[model samples]
Target chain A: MGIAWFVVLSAFIFCIGAAGVLTRRNPLVILLCLELMLNAGNLALLSFARAYGNGDGQVFALIVMVVAACEVVIGLGLIVAMYRNKLAIDADEMSGLRG
Target chain B: MIFEQILFFVAAAGAIGGAVGVVVLRNPFFSVLALVGHLLALAVLFLLLRAEFVAAAQVVVYAGAVMVLYVFVVAYIGGIEEPIGPSAGPLRVLGPLFAGVLLVEIAIATIGSGLRAVSSTGPAVADDFGSPEAIGALLLQKFLIAFEAASFLLLIAAVAAVVLAQRRRGLEEAGGETPLQIGRRPPTGPQAEDPAAAGSGGPAGRAIDERTPTVAQGS
Candidate 1:
């Protein structure tokens, strides 16, 4: 497997995730897209680590996983709170902070 | 060698296809399912790259734990039933336009470099290079501070999540509106005398009460 192919694949996945974040109205879907992007980045890191014959990249991917988990927790909490307050989950409706 | 290439292509197709499914699918629940597929495909790709530890972590932490959190939150929010509406105005054109530009740029950069011929046949990796033990040793030794910090970050996130999601009695007692005030008003009228009538008043209120019992039963 060539490293470049993995890089291109990851870049493609990242773009898809970015598009989802931009176009999707649901906050939960947006969060899922964010996770998708993170995963793509991790894939690239692992591919490079394999090419370089090192373990640091895998370790870094693990750390990224930990951070991503924490982020999801906080994001879900916020989404739940938002649902409680507004009785709506539409991202467009959450314009209270938009200046 | 050819077998690895075939596996890589399959995994790549799966990863990319799943990501497209996540974006194009209307329902958020279905979108999450697509993400799970995407993560699993990526894990397979990681394995193909010889990063077994990373692959396991990807499946365990992401597809297992993080996805469970997502599914739980989706269920909690009662599942977004309505299909997502089309983006309004310039966003409809601009969002895809920008994404297309990004994809084009990346494709150009990747294809122009002539890097595709460079196979991942670097030096012979140690048998333990990408194994769990090697990753753990590296994490606890070179990245020890980061390891501890990640643990600390998780602790803070757990505390913060609890605080954010907690139903605060103080706010309700102070006449301030709690976010989850579906049935915050005192039971008035004849419903006050009839406990059962009050219980079925608002769907949100009923859902809140139901959640507790289901959670208790789950545990």
Candidate 2:
């Protein structure tokens, strides 16, 4: 396997994640797909880091992890707030601005 | 060498399978678990790529803390499966199609580039290249600003999560008692003070209530 293999794998995972985000109605699943996409990016970053013999990509991956955690935190909080308000859990039902 | 190859293949398979499972699983809870598997597999890949510190972080932060939050949220949300909506008709078909096209495009772009000339063995580096100490030095030296910014982002996110999940005052006024006030509180202390404050709080609370749905929809 060359660098291309890992890059291809990363792309494959990203595409899977994008499909999930597009197809899924559940916000939780959409968030999971977002994580998937981020991780795929991390994989590509690490692979390139490996190829280039540097630590910048690893550091970037660490920052990406922090951002991912923060995103999940805010997203789940929103979901909980939505649930508390007795709103419909489905994403489509919550679109109040649909003109 | 052969063992490393086998390990890479195994981790790759696990990662892909778990990603598929996350999307395919109907139960949100199951999806969360599948994501944990995916993260673990990615950690292994990270290790294989010589990102030892990053691998550890992936296991600890992404797989551990983040996934725990996901699990708790899924449980709290009652793991309700999404019913396919009317608008989902075309999207269900088009989503995978577009994603497949994207995959092909990315693959061709990356593989057909000069990156194809690069070998899998990669370049040689110091023995401590991806060790924790090395990455830590980079974090504190080269990437100190970003590291600090990340910590600040985490802090803001923590505060935002708490504020966002706070029980709305409108619901409290409507229910005549706060959710936390029922059964969990002393019978006489806060309960007696509640009605005295209700009238004074109603309009302001309703104003917040009118704003609440907009914030909720912002997600």
Candidate 3:
């Protein structure tokens, strides 16, 4: 029952996050949305782990946590430098590479 | 059924609302905050599922670290005031259309999956792997290689950031400038008041030689 409830909740959150990533122009917001989706994945994995009485899902979630850390750190470092150079964070204004 | 439906509804609302906030909010900082809220709700949901460790990981890593990095950069870039428009034609239409499709897809998939779960006859109960000890064993025993690989990836990312920063235009230019040049304190002696600095620089600029090192110190 408990795991069942969590599965539903995470799914819902995941959907919302995916939508945000699609609609928002801000790169930072898009990153946040991506994080939300990842959390949803972690949730689903955790629920399954609990339901089947296994530790693998939790371990997978830990790996995911580390990956998430790496992603954000790198992502933010790039964003910081980009913002400093260009004076803007809007994805649209970045036309140096655009055709 | 009745109680589960209610909890599900609350979770869905919180998730959807935060998601909407992430999209609709103009300020990236606010969007990040909404994302934190969304992640928190999902973490609690994970706890409800008996995956206590995953829930904690979600909070510490996603909500705590990832989000802080996001918010900090957003604040640093607060001065970025572009007209704030979509990049291309496709992006303008693409954004809303993608969001709409995702919403519809989630609804259908949720229903389909629930039906499947209800009919399945797999393990009647989940396991203790959601516990910290069980997770540790699985990570160290079965998935150690993958674990090491992820660490290697992190190292690569760190190196890449450094490389990218060094190669970037501003960084390249900044690197060429000495501490004195950066703070507008031109070189002293014969080069002290270079002709270009004397012509382009104002009184304050002319007074900066001794102050360059001090300003760098302050910075």
Candidate 4:
């Protein structure tokens, strides 16, 4: 397959993740979708790296993985704290700061 | 060539299907399982792209470590069996519409470009293009600062997560309040003020009372 196919596939996965973020009420599931989006970006980076015959994109993808790991760590910590305070895991129910 | 193409298609199908499952599944546990499938498929795709090191890291980091953390949090928060409430009103329609628009826009841009015709015709990669040795050399040589920064970031995240999740005895003993409960107000309004109506009075107060003793003992 061509590089275009990879790009399109990445885009499709990213959009699915975005939709999940917008629609899902559970913060844990939203975090999972975010991971999906980050993985899609890594796939696109790897495909471009192959297309260019360079290793830079691969290194960049590796760095993205590091950042993703860090994000999940902090995100899950916050979610746990939120669950402790609210006794509910729904994103919509945690709107105490909305006003 | 044909075998590679077929493998790519299979991996692509698995990735897309798993991504859909992650979004559509109600149970967070099932969503996390779908994410594992998605991550594994992405690893295969990385392999097809010749990023061997990245493929291995994908399986190790995203599929294994990250998934374990996700599942742990889901279980900790008692959310494994909780059904996600449906999106209300315009959000139900707007979310899908926005995603569809984004997909169509990307499709048009991709198709309009000449990228489809560009096969994998780049110069032959080095013998160690995606090997662990090559990646390590690049990380320690050209990208040393970035690599160090990533390590530093991870350390900071680890420390911060511990602080965020730790329950402080002093804070709880001061006014029988946890740190997060310091400035929070009791629920207002008519239904929320009733003590006899337990369910209507909000569960936060009860939850805090139930958790304090266990957390104190654990700490």
Candidate 5:
């Protein structure tokens, strides 16, 4: 298929992830959706790399993966800390910062 | 050419299915598992695009280490699941509606102009175009600073995760006893000598006698 097909697929996946983030109250599920979004971006990057015939996109994708890993780690750690503090785990209930 | 197209479609199906599963599943544990499947499918897509090293990293880092952490956290949280349906009123309808609009907008943008800059069949490439050696060379040459920065970021993330997950001593008392500590109190007076007698005791004695079998059994 053409690169357009790949880009469209990436967009589709990203939208699915966005919907998940918006709809899901569970922080863990939200994180999972974030992962989906990141992966979709990676797919698009790889497709562009293939289209241009180079390794730069691959390298960029690798760095994105590292950053994604860090994000997931910090997110899960926050969730654990919240749980430990006996705070309600629901995203809706995490309003301690609300003015 | 036809084979490649078929493979792409299959992997795309897998990726979309897993993404949907992650969103639709109520249980966070199941959601984590679904994400694992999604990551694996993305790895296949990476391979289809000739990003061999990235595909391997996708499987190893995303599907392997990241998903494992997600699964562990889900398990630790126990049976807690997302409440049925959206927790907020507008979210029930607005969420999907907005997402649909986003999809249409993105699709139009993608189809209209995103691929116009590149040739459909792509440019010719060397055998090592996306190989580990080529990527390594690119990292050392053009992207050395970024590579080093990524490593530094990872180190910070590791330290941060450890610190964030650790229970702060002050908060433990401030938040009151955790579920594990709710019923158990310290051994004092007769209970100090006799583990059977539950104590109206000091926190220090409670800490000391925490492992005592009778105290464990009583709690």
Candidate 6:
């Protein structure tokens, strides 16, 4: 029962992140979407970790959380510096990164 | 089955609603608030699943610490101002969808592989999960590498923040100077007099004196 609820909720959140990445032009929004995706990952991991008797999944989830934090700080700082150089935080504005 | 299932559905609904609010809301402040609410409800759901330690950690780390950092950053940035178009490119959206599909597929496979685990017919203590004690033992012993890595990662993040902030215009880090630096150097007596009290000596000196950056430059 809980697994079903977790799966459905996780799926919905995952879709939002998907839609955000598909829709947002701003880099910060993209970053937010990325975080949303990571959060969904954590939900799924913890849910399975609980359903099963093993604690390994929960430990893995913790590691992911730490990694996500590092990603956010560096990503945000990069965005801020980019905005300073270009005066905009829009992902589309960063054509220099495009091939 | 009935009451437990109902409570689970309610919390699930709250979680989903908050998750939607995070994306659909115009203000990221409200979005972050919604995210906090979502994480809290999710932690409750974790408790219902009997994962007490994970639930507590979710509240402490995710809901408390991580969300606080996010709110601080959002407040510092103020608002998105220019407004993100609608979303990013389609490829970005595809990434999350792939994860969703992968999760669904895995769930299906897991359930099909063994109905016994998902049945919930017997007591949940079916296994000697020993979750709390096991987690503590692993934290202190087996996974000490990861525990150490997390702390090291946080330290690096703090240093990076300090360095980046220091590099910003007008702000400096250690061994840097400010206009206030002039006041801190060894005093040369009269020149070291407080600017606030210096030009207030005479009535006329007080007249046009404080208005200008300098006064009585002539010999």
Candidate 6 per-residue lDDT over residues A22-98, each given as its tens digit: 65666666677777788778777767766676677777777777888887777777666665555566667776863
Model 6 residue B13 CA deviation in Å: 1.1
Estimate, for each residue in B61-167, the C-alpha lDDT of model 3 and write its tens digit: 77887777776787777723323346557766776677567757765665567444432322544456367876677778899998889889889988977876665
Which is the better candidate, 2 or 6, if ranked by DockQ? 2
lDDT of each: 0.80, 0.83, 0.67, 0.82, 0.84, 0.68
Candidate No. with top DockQ: 2
lDDT, model 2, position B205: 38
For candidate 5, write residues B1-219 as lDDT tens digits. Answer: 899999989999999999999999988888888888888888888887889999998898889988888888988988476676754588788988999999999877776774564438577778888898999999999999999999999999999987786657666676675654555543234554675444443345445555465465567
Worst 10 residues of 3 chain A by lDDT: A90-99
TM (chain A) per model:
0.93, 0.94, 0.88, 0.92, 0.95, 0.90
Interface Cα root-mean-square deviation for all models: 1.8, 1.4, 3.6, 1.8, 1.3, 3.7
The TM-score measured for candidate 4 stands at: 0.81
lDDT by residue (tens digit), candidate 1, A23-80: 8878888888888888888987887787788888888888889888998999999898
Positional deviation of B55 in candidate 5, in angstroms?
0.1
Output the lDDT of residue B208, model 4. Answer: 67
TM-score values for chain B across all models = 0.72, 0.74, 0.65, 0.73, 0.74, 0.61
Model 2: per-residue Cα lDDT over B25-76, one tens digit each:
9899999999999999999988888999999988888888888888888888
Off by over 4 Å in 3: A2-11, A95-99, B1-12, B79-90, B113-127, B164-219
Give fnat for candidates 1, 2 and onward, in order.
Answer: 0.79, 0.86, 0.52, 0.78, 0.82, 0.25
The alpha-carbon deviation from the true structure for residue B197 of candidate 6, after best TM-score superposition, in angstroms, is 45
Ranking by lDDT: 5, 2, 4, 1, 6, 3
